[model samples]
Target: MILHDFLPSGNGYKIRLLCACLGLNVTLKEYDITKGETHTESFLAINPNGKIPVLELDNGQCLSESNAILLYLTEQNHLTQQHQSALLPADPILKARVYQWLFWEQYSHEPNIASPRFWLTHNAMTDLKKRMLPDRIQQGHVALKLMDDTLAQHTFLVGDAMTLADICLFPYTHVAEEGGAYQLSEYPNIQRWIKQIEALDWFIPITQG
Candidate 1:
């Protein structure tokens, strides 16, 4: 499989991390979105929206969206589930809870962590006009508080063990501190959990280039 991604992007990190964990043989194709590469006619043919982390299969089929890619890559693997309690809850109610957090990650989490990171860390001052500072800071803290509160109780998000939920949320979240909102020191459970993830054999620090 050929995975076209932005090497520095969290969305791309999601797939790269998953590939490493699953031992999938995926060729990495890095694209420079900052240079308007995604907008090119050829890339738009593969994905009309023109985004990075576009996974193209051997048959020439393509998939976009990071979460979708994660599910696709890991679902059938032995490590498809590491800790069910934290990620894939066994109980119907708890499983639903896991999904809730996963959904929240995409909806509530990324807007806060990823968007602001792009503007503050990557983009030029001219790009600043497009960002909504008040909303970004507001929503980012909201997500952080939710994580801090829930993580205060347990070492992991959904259960005692790390699950897919953690993988889904960790990318944007771990870097939320850059947005000036993350205080992992205040959430000891989360701090411990971060360490655990880092210790995994397949784990790759997304922050590193």
Candidate 2:
């Protein structure tokens, strides 16, 4: 498998992190999204949406969208006896909870947190983004608070065991302060959760491929 990705991207990092946890060997195809690399004709052929983190399987089929790839990897891992813990639980209720976090991350978390981080850190800010920043930051706090409150009740997002939900949210949430949009200090539970994830043996930094 090959991961078409940009190293700095949390979305790309999501797939990379999961592959590390699953002990999967996937070739990394780096792209400098800063240079419009993902928009090139060849990259476009892989994902018409022009996004990074497209996972190309051994048979040449490609999967786009980060959370979808996470689910795919976990499902594939479930079929083998290699990984001990299940990232996506078999219980219907628990699986639904995992799905909930994945959807919420895209809709409520990423747009507010990830977008502002990108705009500020990458020098991509504009007049419209400047106007949008305040509101995004506010909503980001709301999203973080929700995660914090939920995490305050359990070790991980869904329950005691770590699930796909934690992996999905960790990338952006851990580095949210980069663009001056958030302070992890304000969310103590989240801080603790971040530490717990980092201490895992297979954990990989976002900077890692």
Candidate 3:
């Protein structure tokens, strides 16, 4: 399998981390998104949307969208049933909760957190991007506070262990202060949850050269 990705992208990092945890050896094809690499004809043929983190399977099929790829990979790993139950639980309702968080991350969380981080850390600060900051921070805090309140009651998002939801949400939230310009220290439960995720045996850092 070939994983087309841009390192430093939290979306891509989620796949990399999951592959590592599953002990899957997938060839990584790095692209510089800033150079319009993802927009190339070859890449567009693979995923017309021109998104990074496209997974080309051994059978010559391609999958796009980070979370979808994550679900695919996790579903492919049969060992997860005995070892990584939280990833995709057998219970229908438990699995639904994981999906709930995944959707919320893309809609409610990433818009405010990841989008702002890209503009603040990677893109040139233009008038429009600059103008978007206040609203992003406001919405970002709402997401963080909600997570904090939920986490104050549980160690992980779903059942007893970290699920797909936690992995999906962790990267953006961990780096929230960089984009939102609000200290994570203010959310003590979030800080504690961050530490818990970091302590996982197969975890990988988001930072990459």
Which candidate number would show the highest lDDT if scored against the true structure? Answer: 2
lDDT of 2 at 43: 93
Per-model TM values vs. the true structure: 0.85, 0.97, 0.94
TM-score of 1: 0.85
Worst 10 residues of 2 by lDDT: 77-86
- Per-candidate Cα lDDT values, in order, are 0.74, 0.94, 0.86
Per-residue alpha-carbon lDDT of model 3 for 122-176, expressed as tens digits?
A: 7657898789889988998899999999999899877567788888888788888
Candidate 2 residue-wise lDDT, 63-174, digit = tens: 9999999998989876324445578988899999999999999999999999999999999999999999999999999999999999999999999988899999999999
| Candidate that beats the other on TM-score, 1 or 2, i.e. the better one | 2
Number of clashing residue pairs, candidate 2: 0
**What lDDT score goes with residue 39 in model 1?**
88
Estimate candidate 3's alpha-carbon lDDT, on a 0 to 1 scale.
0.86
lDDT digits (tens) for residues 63-102 of candidate 1: 9988777767655454534423323545788767777887
Alpha-carbon runs more than 4 Å astray in model 2: 79-84
Candidate 2 pairs with clashing backbones: none
Weakest lDDT window of 10 consecutive positions for candidate 1: 78-87
